[model samples]
Target: MQKIVDTAKGLEGLKRQWGVHAAGVILSRDPLVDVLPIHKREQDGAIITQWDMGACESIGLLKMDFLGLRNLTILDDCLDAIRENRGEDVVLEQLPLDDKPTYELLARGDTLGVFQFDGGPMRALLRSMIPDNFEDISAVGALYRPGPMGANAHNEYADRKNNRKPVVPIHPELAESLADILGDTYGLIVYQEQVMAIAQKVAGYTLGKADLLRRAMGKKKKEILDKEFQPFSAGMKEQGYTDAAIKTLWDILVPFSDYAFNKAHSAAYGVVSYWTAYLKANYPAEYMSGLLTSVGDDKDKSAVYLAECRRMGIKVLPPDVNESMARFAAVGQDIRFGLAAVRNVGTNVVEAIRRCRKEKGAYTDFYDFLRKVDAVACNKKTIESLIKAGAFDSMGHPRKGLLAIHADAIDSFLDIKRNEAVGQYDLFGDAFGGGDDAVGAGMVVTPQIPAGEWDKGDLLTFEREMLGLYVSDHPLFGVEHVLTAAADMTIGALAEESSVGDGAVVTLAGILSGVQRRITKQGRAWASATLEDLGGAVEVLFFPNTYEIVGQYIAEDAIVVVKGRVDRRDDQPRLMAMDMSLPDITAADEVKPVVLALPRPGARRRWSSGCARC
Candidate 1:
């Protein structure tokens, strides 16, 4: 384990492949060429050093770090939205750190949009620690990382923090010098600044020399330790401390120097974490609007954050041509989906729509929009995408009707535009909104819209196809609740393979689509079907034997619960069915009895042959 850690830590310097600091800008009194070798960053074409910040610092040059944080941008967006929608300038940075509501929200682990505190393990830690103050929030961020996390450090720190474990020091005499710095950290050596402070106070070393001591300890060099220990022990002896006291304190420092976080950096990040939690607690809609916008292009991440928004009781409506913006927007207390998320809906189309809506109030109907909107921007493909994403749903037309009439609408609008260019309008009529007199022989035609919704499968498939996810409803919405509770793993888990192993048995409930069946070379029958639920999708392959047994259920748009082995041999893993059946809610009592409990543990279940279907 120690070797593994050292190997992982060694890669930190090489991870960027001989790259320089992200925002390090070095200023020199002399020409840059006279000081060091330089090159432009490959990613952004900025001038940078061939050596890292440490090497530059050692060579007597100043390095300044200017980092652009995503959380700051998220906060800025949230504040701007608040000012626009609610007419109040919310000064998040100026808010008090002692807010009870923020702490309570943190305790519930509802920090989906918060910086540095939203990981699964960190959320669990927050739930257990129940942070009541700002200091604890900061400490969790500093301690939750991989390097500093081991040997029950989290438990020890949390226990000591909440008074479940007593604080103890290396020596009773050292407590007076250490209490001010480490009292809040449960006497644990959590920061490099504390290492410098302890070295100065206990060993009579000057602060500058103590920093060198800090460096020597961090490197774990045997020669440097041999050269430095005599001075450290001699200074402590002069301070009237015994030899045993010196060893006890020095022993703790040895392991700590490996990964002790810098105090200033940890505190800064911790405060940002708390600030984001505060924003999530107070202005959920505005904060999630920015959060959704930041990850709009990524389907999986968008799904996760949208679920978080729902958990916060913030409704996420589908895109609306009448009211939607280019990016996600806050509509009173809810977040309105953005048009940019729809697949193939280009930037020009969104801009044209926004411009038209801004100049001419909300769109009256579909045909009205097509007549005035730019035909170059609003083409067949763009119109189809808009309809599939439900942007026209608010205009009193179902997606199917709009999809069917999109080409007709665009053609009619373009014909009118060509005639208007040719001077076809009535000279005696008003320029706009004067009924039939506005155009000499022209008439506005509204497309006929049916009164019923489309087939559930078609509606959801189109939504998932164009918007990257199912917004109105999932294909398996009817029995998903019962099947999800009874299944071994979800379709999402099988597709993502988050923690499932190759060739492991699993059970899932999903709407089957894209069914392909054929006769094998040996004259046996086989089939493959795509089973998809809201979170994700996976392919279920039925070999001859299983296909013969479940052939009736292998069809598009049919929801089935299946127990299978995840076949990881393929480049993209697939599920090989072991057993299958239609989802029957009333059979929960019968199915649970036969479902085999595999060795896999916790909320995620892996299956075996004995596992039964729902």
Candidate 2:
């Protein structure tokens, strides 16, 4: 208050804010004279003084940031999932930078949790402009933006990577100045470091000055840029560069400066990209688990993650109370769906279930669970959500049975406890001790299924309804072989062979994992068709032509084979189905295994012994 009053009394436009200044305050042998007459408090038999940041800095104290980046947490979670799933502790930091699979992942746009590639548009860009090298990853990280979305940049990038195009030199003299920065990115200014290096090499700018200019360009200050340009041009000519070459290079470099991305930032994110690639290539199950685990409470995200899991052929098992943690967990390679992901199933409820299960064993049946933690963790709505989510199907009941009986089961459970509390215990006198014969123990009063059981399709659909995904199995598992010969490829292999404009006629058979649609700029809706083969998954592009014909077959988890060209648009590749078929599995027949016979050891010896006589 006194400082504020003093600042208010100062000259006009004082601009007083909390500021730190540096000064040396020495302690004398006689402690009283060296110090100012100010309030002092002792701290553990020591004097404590508060100093501001600038004061500390001026006094040569170093500042270190304890930065907790979200990416780091995500990285940790991803690694943890990988470790749990793969049973190997992969040190992501130690991965080789030039991994083929890592580059391949970028090329294919399988960029979920892949550092800077996590955004929808970024994935689309990666798919369209398949990055073939770490430098491509870095360059894309830098080059992709509103301003730097250069004409034919994606094509140029792809061509350069495939060695179909040369790394063009903007200026003959500046070749060495740009070579290292360009690396495999074909002489593009895709990193701020490149700009800095260019400034240093071409115009003799100090690193500090280069950084300042880079910042000025990013700020897009006309006056500052104009002032800086004269020195830059003069420096260029002094180095014996022609005026025309300098001007041309300057035009390219100046525009790039506006969004000249940081190289360190790109490198850091590239590490995450590489880590995800390594996981996808070597430890897919763990990658899927982490991917699914992180999609907290988002059915849409989970749906996408699940589709990726299926695409990767990583099995996502239904949420088993016994196996499931509050969050999604990896049980072997299978992602045990998270209880927290179910609608209305709060974290607290999940914690309660976790605690109850820890105290006891896994709920023997749904009723065993209901008796102990149901009232505490689950309400009618919570139970209903769990039913709809299929968290209880493992309790020896169809999902419909569980869903139908939830109210009666819950009410009956409450009534039984109430009766036992009141004086009605003798009516259900302990047939055995310790309430072992309790009404809801070892048996739950579920509604009866009709005479016939649910068909495979219905069962899968029920699981899908609850899990926000198909977990038990894909709908098209039976037609996997037929689909394979038709498609002539595995999902993992599709991206390996195709060129940017090349297309392959294939028959892809799989269960319809999911369909996501979006409107293009001109208001035309385009859809992405996700299908899961027995081996893995392939994404089909539903162009207006394909969607009009096969859209209905795709909406259900039906067994369908799509005949289409292997589509390459963005660096990513997927099948754009032009034809669809649903094959019948019932018409197929099974055959028995054949066994070979061998002589017994003693008989062989006898035969050998008798051979001379024969």
The lDDT leader among the candidates is 1
C-alpha root-mean-square deviation, candidate 2: 14.1
Q: Which stretches of candidate 1 lie over 4 Å from their true place?
A: 1-20, 40-44, 52-54, 171-177, 237-245, 421-447, 476-484, 487-614
Best candidate according to TM-score: 1
- Across 415-516, the per-residue lDDT of candidate 1 in tens digits comes to 666666676754544665553324222464656765677897788888878887777666554455677775876554455534588978888887787799
Candidate 1's clash total is 1
Candidate 2, superposed: residue stretches over 4 Å from native = 1-71, 83-87, 98-100, 118-136, 151-157, 176-185, 221-223, 357-359, 364-374, 377-379, 418-431, 435-614
Error of 1 at 527 (Å): 10
Worst 10 residues of 1 by lDDT: 597-606
Q: Residue by residue across 1-614, what tens digits does model 2's lDDT show?
A: 99988877785575445322233343334453243332345444533335544444564555443445555665677677766666667687788888877766766677765666765556767765666567667667766664466544555665666566887877787787668767656766667787888888889999999988788777777898798889999999998888987888887877777765687887766766677777766666666666666666455556556767776666777776667776767777666888876667788889888887888677877777777673556478788777666676677756666766677778867665566666576443454333524655433364443233367677766666655565676665545555655655555445443222357576666667667876768776667877765444667777776676766666656667777887676666678778787776654335223445434322456777787788
Q: List per-prediction Cα lDDT, in the order shown.
A: 0.77, 0.66
TM-score per candidate, in order? 0.79, 0.61
Would you give me the overall lDDT of model 2?
Answer: 0.66
| RMSD of every prediction | 9.0, 14.1
Model 1 Cα RMSD, Å?
Answer: 9.0
